[model samples]
Target: MKKLALAVVVTMASSLCAMAASDVTKSPPPAPYEQVSKLVKLPDFLPGMGALFVDPATLPAGPFLAYDHGGKLVSTIYMLPIKDLNPDKRFDNLAAPGGNVDHVDVYYNAGHPGVPEPHVHVVLWHVPAADEARVAK
Candidate 1:
């Protein structure tokens, strides 16, 4: 009958629309895995007046390095996409040779050397082995 055919057509159209809508609402693919390189030493004059340095050899899709203003080698830092990280989490505590990290700063290159491609420079500070216990606490 005509009514039966109309009902069938409506059901088919609704189903198709539902399928299309579901596709649109589907979650996007997971972000690519970021490569992390080995910890490298920083140059004396990198930035902040010998306060920061990055080891060229340990670049992980980067040009990141460790930094220490006091020249004690306290912690290390690297460049990573801001979108790929948790804002509340500390990268040093997540990954680094020295567990005690003072802080981290993310900077976009402003005519600065060795930035833009790697997109990040990680600053790490050194914690004395003897002071590890005190620092940890």
Candidate 2:
């Protein structure tokens, strides 16, 4: 069962990486931050989550690209609203916009700007756990 899940995740990652191939050479890949910010209200930088870029239309299920201070792609985040996680609902095939995730972290968030509803943040970290401190406030 775990192997099946791993296979599925790998396939999705590969697909996303291919879709991003044109931009991958650019550090962080999801630039220029200003253009992305125009589409969504992205902060200068988000502690722990790093700088983010997401299309408002894809909210809640965002493959929100996260980047480090030096513009390194660090993680891909998904903000899943608590109300939507019930048995009837499933967020399947959620893409990891930044490929090669080193690990994943899921945590509850009561609410915040841009995402005001209570939600869970599914963070797919591209860096090793030890390197995550790069985004610490």
Candidate 3:
């Protein structure tokens, strides 16, 4: 039910955004949520909820879709700049201090064309920070 609603909202928003002023280029498609999810082996998720869309080319990282058991989007994952995060461990190194801290999980997103710098994004489960930044706009 939640996915359906979200899809509906996305469809409507896309339609409206399509009617933008002639000066603006239409928005690119959202990030390849499923592909990225598989790439990182998201620690948590719900069926069909993986179909999230955030263009990776512009943003440094992600709001990788995380769903609660009910299939509603509960959080996001995105990469911070490598120079800032300065992580010493690999992206998939779940042992890192930030990996699972504060309801968030971190993962490596290397060699991905969308990422400008090699860095990690976090699966911020139930974290208002991620949601506050992108969603609820």
Best by lDDT: 2
Tens digits of per-residue lDDT for model 2, 1-137: 99999999999999987776546423445543322455546667878877777655687568777778887778878899999989999988987656677999999999877778999998998889999998886
Report how far off residue 42 is in candidate 2 (Å).
6.0
Cα deviation of 110, candidate 2, in Å:
0.5
- TM per candidate comes to 0.34, 0.74, 0.35
Q: Model 2: runs farther than 4 Å from truth?
A: 1-19, 22-42
Q: Candidate 3 at 76: error in angstroms?
A: 0.5
Q: Please provide, for model 3 over 87-131, each residue's C-alpha lDDT reduced to its tens digit, 9 standing for 90 to 100.
A: 573434322211233476567656454455777666665535544
Candidate 2 clash figure, as a count? 0
Give lDDT: candidate 2, residue 63. 70
lDDT value for candidate 3? Answer: 0.46
User: Each candidate: what lDDT?
Assistant: 0.41, 0.76, 0.46
Error of 1 at 97 (Å): 1.3
lDDT score, candidate 3, position 106 = 63
